[model samples]
Target: MTQIAYFEPSYTAHNARDWEIRGSYKYPSLLGDLHTMAKITLLMPTLPPETDPHRIMLETNYDVRFVALDTLDDAGDANIESLVEDYATAIANLEPDIVSTLNGRMIGHNFALARAAKAVGKDFVYRIAGNDIATQIAVREAAGRPVTGTAYLATLIAQERYAAEVARSVIVMGGTERERAAGRVADPSKIHICRRGVDQSHFTPAANASKSCNRILFVGRNSAEKGIDLIEGAADMLAKTRPEIEFTVAGDFDPRTEGNRHYLGFHGYADLPTLYQDHDALLLPARSEGFPQVVMEAMSCGLPAILSKSLFEHDFGAGDGVTLIDRDVRSIVDAISSWHDDDSLFAKVRSEAIGQAKEHFDATENGEHYHTILLGQGK
Candidate 1:
C-alpha cells in the first residue's frame, strides 16, 4: 500500500476521534477512507502542556497512526528552523511516499512542512483549506490595509506564491479556488477542485416530524468576519418585531441568553445533526470562505441556509438550497422573515436543500475523489 503522511496542525484530542462523536469529521472521514487504500499517517502538533497527547492517538482509528511533533507549537510556528529540521527528520523516519498538508499558507508550519517534504524527496501536495491567497488579499484590502504597505502581508503573499509554485499538486475546494490557483500555479492541470463532503446517513433529515420555521441556527466562529454581529443585530431586532423567531448560536463562545437569542455553547459532531433538524434554517454571513461544511450538514438535515451573497455566488448559484443575501442586519432579518411567513417556500427550500446534499455532497463519493487526487491517479 502507498504510504501517505497527512499534516494538519490544528488536529487535536478534541477533534480527532475513531468513532463518530464531537466536532467536525471532514478530516477524519477523508483520512478514514484514504486509510483503506493507503497507509495513512496523521501528523499533528503536540497538544498544550495540560492536554494529554496520548488521548489523540487513543481516540484516533487504529488503522491510521497519529504522530505528534513535540518541537512544533499549536500553530506550528515555534522555532522555525528547529521545527523544519524536526519535521524533515520525522518525514525521513516515516518514509511516506506523499506528504500532504492543509492550508498551505505563508505560516511557518506549512512553509516548513513543504520544505521538509522536499528535503526528504517526498512529493508535497498543497491543499488550500480555505479561501485562496488572492481572495484573502482582497479581503485584507477591502478592510483598508494595502498589501504593499504591510510588511507581514507582503511576506505572506510571497511565501504562499512560492509554496503554490513548488507543490507537486494543489487541491482546492471549489471553482473560485481553481481559478485563483491558475494565476499562481505554473501548470493549470495540477490544480484540482475537490469539495468537502457530508455523510448523508449521519446528517439526514428528521424522521416523522413536522416542520416549524421558528428556530434559526448559527454554527461557526463568533467573530465579525463570520458575520456573527449581523446575526446578533438581526436576532435583537426580530425579538421585538417577531417574538416567535429565536436564534441559537453554537461554537467555541461564551453563552448568552436574552429574549429569543440563546447561545448553546460548543457542540460535538454527533449533536449537530439534531441541532440542524430542530432548527428551521442555518445562517452564515461570513466575509469569506472556501466551502463551508456547516451549509452542507444543515442542508443534509433538510434545513435551508441563508448565506453571504458575495462570498458564495461562485460556488452556490441560484436554486442550490441556499438563500443568498447581503451581509447586513436588514438582509438577514428579511430573509428569515420571508421563510417564516411563507410555508410553501420553506418546504420547497427544505426539499431542495436535501436534494442538493444527497446529490453532490455525499462523503463516500468525495472521499474517493480525494483518494484519487492524493495518489496522483487523476494525472
Candidate 2:
C-alpha cells in the first residue's frame, strides 16, 4: 500500500516551531489530501514516549503514530553518530517501509529517523526549506569570491559533494529559480523541486475593509533576514510623507525593539487574516525566502505588496501588484505613495495579487504532489 512514515521533528506546532507546518497543514485545499495519505505515521521525538490513541486521533489521520527520543537541539553542531544510536532502536520497534523527513537533516528528530533509515536499509526521503539550502549556496558563493579564492571554493566544493553523496533522495521547495538550478545536480533525479502552494479562500479581500484604517502589516520573526530594519526605515519615510498611515509588525514582535513599529504580536489564524484584510498592503523585504508563505497569505487577503527585488522574481512577478525595491527606504516610500494616490490601480494590483496566490501557493495541490511522490506516482 506504499506505506511511508512522515518524519517531522514533531506534529504539534509547539515543538517544530518553523514555517513549514502552517504552510502544509493549514492550507485549506492541501490538508484534505494530507489526511488521506496511505498509512500516514507521524514519527516525532517523544519523551514520555508510548504512542497514544489521542495523538493519532488528534492528527485526524488514524494511521498516525509517535516515537519519543532524547531531546537534542537541532541548531547545535550535531553529527550522525548519536542520532543513529537514538533512532535505530525506535525504527526497529516501529518497522516502517519508508521514511520521509520534511525538514531533513537540519531538524533534530528527523536526524534520528534518517539514521534509522540508513541502518535498516530503508528509503530516506529528505525535504529542505529555502533557507537551509540557500545558506549552503551562499557559503559556496562567498567562498568563490576573490577574497576566498580557489582554496576556499575547493573546500566548499568537497562539502557540497558530500551533501550530494548522502541521502537516498531529496525534496526541495524552490522559492527562486536559483534554488531550482542549484538542486539539479544535488543528486541526479533524487532531488526534485516540490513547489509550495497557497490558499485563496481565506485570503480574499475583506468585505468589512470599508471600516478598516490605513495600515500596512509585516508578518514574520524579528530577524536580520526578514528585513525588519529596512521596513522600519521605509516606515520612517512614510511617517514623513503620510503622517496618517500606520505600520504594524506581527509575530516574534517586540514593541521596544522596532523603532516605530506598532507590535501586534503573534495572532492565531482567525485574527491574522483580519490583520491582512484591514491593512492597506503587506511589506516583506526578505533577505532570503523559499516561496514565502507569508507573501501568499498576504496576497490572499487582497493586500498588495512592497517586497524586495529578491522576492518578486519569476512567476512571482513584480508589477504594480508588487512594489519591488532594492532594499532602499526611498523605494519603499515611493511604492506606498503610488498605491495611496491611485484607487483603481491599487484595486487592480490587489486583484492580481489574489489571483496569483490562488494559482501558485495552494498547499492542497502541494500535498497532492507529496502523496504522489511517496506513493511512487511522482508529480
Candidate 3:
C-alpha cells in the first residue's frame, strides 16, 4: 500500500467531485491507483476534521486515504513549526509508498510533505499550475520591483532549485507552440500534462424539442485573456443578422478591467449539463489555454463548440469536438452560421464531439494516466 498526500487550496469546491468524491464515483484520483497495484491515499489540507484520510479512506473500494493539513485559507502561511509536526504525524499514520499533489495549490502541504519525505529519504513531486508559472515568470521579469516584492515567486523558485530537481516532477498542462519553441516542454518523459478533464455525466447535452429559442452559451471568466471581446463581437453580429438568437455569458466577470457584458456570475460544475442543454452552442474564443476544460465539458453534453483556433491547432485538435475559428469576430459569426444552416453537418460533428469526450476526457482514463505516473509506468 502506498500513501499519496494531496495539498490543495480547498476541499468543498463547486468543481470536480473526483478529488472530493461527493455525488458519485469520480475516476480521476483513486480508481486508477487501485487498478495499478497501489493503495492511493488522498489528503485534502483544506477540508474539515471528520473527512480526514483515516475516515474517508474507508468510504470507497478504491483503497484510498484522505487527510487534511489545515483549514487555513491563506497560501503564504509562514508559521509551520507546529503544522509541519502535524503533517509528520499524518504521514506516519498513512505510511504511503509515494506522495504527490493532484493539482498544484497545496505548495505549503507539498513542502511540508517533502521535508518529511526527506527525513526518511523518500521521493516526492510538487505539482504546479499555469497561474503559478505565469506568476513566477512575471516576478523574475518585473522591472524595478524590490526583491521582497515577489517573495512568493522567489520562494517557489528557490524550493525547485534546492530540492533534488530530478525528484520533483512539475505536472504541467501540455505546452503551447510558443512554450514548445521556448523549450518549456522539451522532454515529454519528464513533464506530464494533465490537462482539462470532463465530468461527462453532467456536461452531456439534451434536445431542445419544443421550440424556437436559439441559445448561445458562453462559460468562463469574463477577462481580456478569456477573449470576451471576441465572443461579444460575434454575439453582436449574430444579433444583427438573426435578431432572434439569445446569447448568454455564464460565469464570473471582472467589471473593472474587461468592461461589462451579460453575466451569470459563477455556476457550479453540476449545473453545466443543464447549462449546455439550454444552449445551442458553446463559444470560447479564449486567447490562451494550457487546456480548455469548458470546451470539453460542452462537447460531452453533445453540444457543438466554436473554440479558438489557437487551441484547435494542437496535436489532438482535429479529432476533438471543436469548430475551429480565428479570433476575428466575423469568423465566429460565420462558423455559427454554417452550423445553423447545415443541420446534417451539425448532427455529424455533434456526435463526433460526444465520442471524443467519452474517449479522451473520461475520468477513468485520466486516473489511469496518473496511476501510471505514480507507479513509474511507461510513457
Candidate 4:
C-alpha cells in the first residue's frame, strides 16, 4: 500500500476558537474516500499544541490518522526552517511514499513540505490553489489588505517558485491556476488540471423546493477579491429596477455593507446546503479563484450560477451551466434581469447545473483520480 502524507496549514474555521469542535464539511467526501483507498496521514500545525493528537474523534475518519506539530507563536506561524525540520522528522516517522500539499503558496505549510521532500530525496506533489501572484496583487489593490511584509511576500514567492521547480508533479485546481503555474515551472508537462469537487449527497436539492423565483445569493469570504463591493453595487442597482429580486450574501461577509441586501453571517459547512437551497441562484463575481468549492456545492443543490467571466473562463468552459458577466454593477444587474425574464433559459441552466455537478463534481471520483496520480499510475 502506498503511504501519502497530506499537509495543510490550518483546519480551524473562521469564527471558531477551538480546533477540535471546528467543522470539516469539506473533507469527509474527498479525504474520507482517500482513506479507504490508501493510507493517508493528515499532518497539521497547531498553536498551544493539542495533548492527544493521536486520539480519534467521532467526526474524523477512523482510517486516517491525525498528527499535529507545534508552531512558534500563538498565531500558529512556523518558520520555514523549523517547518522543514519538523516535516523531515514526520517523514522519518511516517515513511510516506509521496508527500502532498494542498496549498502550494509561499507561506503555506506545503512549501516547507516541498523543501523537506527535496532535502530527503522523496517525491513531492504540490496542489496549487487560485491565489497566484496576480490575484494577490489584485486583492492588495482592491481590499487594502496587507500582503504579509514586502520582504515576506518576496520570500513566499521565491518559495513557491522553488516548489514548482522541484516538485515531481503538480495538481492545479483549475485551468487558470495551471496556466499560472506553467508560467513559473520549468516543465509544464508536470502540471495537471483538477477542479474542486463536492459531496452531492450532503448538498442535495431541497425536498420541498419552494425557493423564490428571483432570489440571488453570494457566499464567500468578505474579501475584496471576492467582489463584495461589486455585490453591494449590484444589489443597489437591482433594488431600484427589479425591486422584487432579493439579494443575500451568506457566509463570512462584512456586516457594515452599504446595501439593502440581507447579509447572513458566516455559515459553516453543516449549514451551507440548506442555505444554498434557500436561494434561486449564486452570484459570485470573484477576481480570482481555483474552482470555488461553494459553486460546486451550490450546483449540487441544483442552483444555477452567475459568475465573473474570468472565473467562468478559467474553470467552467463555455456551454456549462453558468451565466458569465463582467464583475461590474451593470453587468450583474443585467444578468439578474435576464435570468428572471427568460423561463426556458432559467430552467435549462438549473437542470444543467445539477447535471454538471453529478457528472464532474463527485468527491469520490476526485479522490480516486488523486490516488491514481499519487501512486504514479497516471503519470
Question: Each candidate: RMSD to true structure?
Answer: 4.0, 5.1, 5.9, 3.7
Model 2, span 1-379: residue lDDT tens: 5566655454443543343343334322333455455555555554212343334343544444445544443423354456666567656666766777544344334445555677887776656555443444444454563523455445444433443345565566654533553554544666666655555565577885532225778998766567777788888877776776788888877554344468866676556677788788888877766656677788877787888786556435655367777877778778777877777777778777777766666666766775566555653
Q: Write the residue-wise lDDT of candidate 4 on 1-379 in tens digits.
A: 7788877555552224234323244344445456656687766664223343423441255476667755432212346678778788888777888888643343346667788898887889887766665567677766666665676578667777888788888887777678778977989988886654777788997776533458888887767678888888888887888788888887655564345688877776678898999888999998877778888889899888998886667667555778889878899888888878787777778888888889888887876776666667785
**Runs with alpha carbons beyond 4 Å of true place in candidate 1:** 10-26, 45-62, 74-78, 102-106, 132-148, 208-212
TM-score of 4: 0.85
lDDT at residue 96 of model 3 (Cα atoms):
63
Using TM-score as the measure, name the better of candidate 1 and candidate 2. 1
Q: In model 2, where is the ten-residue run with the lowest total lDDT? A: 22-31
lDDT score, candidate 2, position 4 = 62
Number of the candidate with higher lDDT, 2 or 3: 2
Give the Å shift of residue 260 in candidate 3.
14
Per-residue lDDT of 1-379 in model 1, one digit per residue for the tens? 9998877554443444422231135456565456668887767674322243433543455365667765555332346678678889989989999988632333555667778888888888888867544445655676886654576666665666666777888888877667767887678899887766888889999985346578899998664467777898999999888899999998867898877888877677778899888888999988767777888889898888999887777677667788899989999999999988888888888888888888888888887888789899885
Candidate 2 segments exceeding 4 Å error: 10-31, 47-57, 103-116, 133-169, 175-191, 195-199, 208-214, 255-260, 318-320
lDDT top scorer: 1
Better structure of 2 and 4 per lDDT: 4
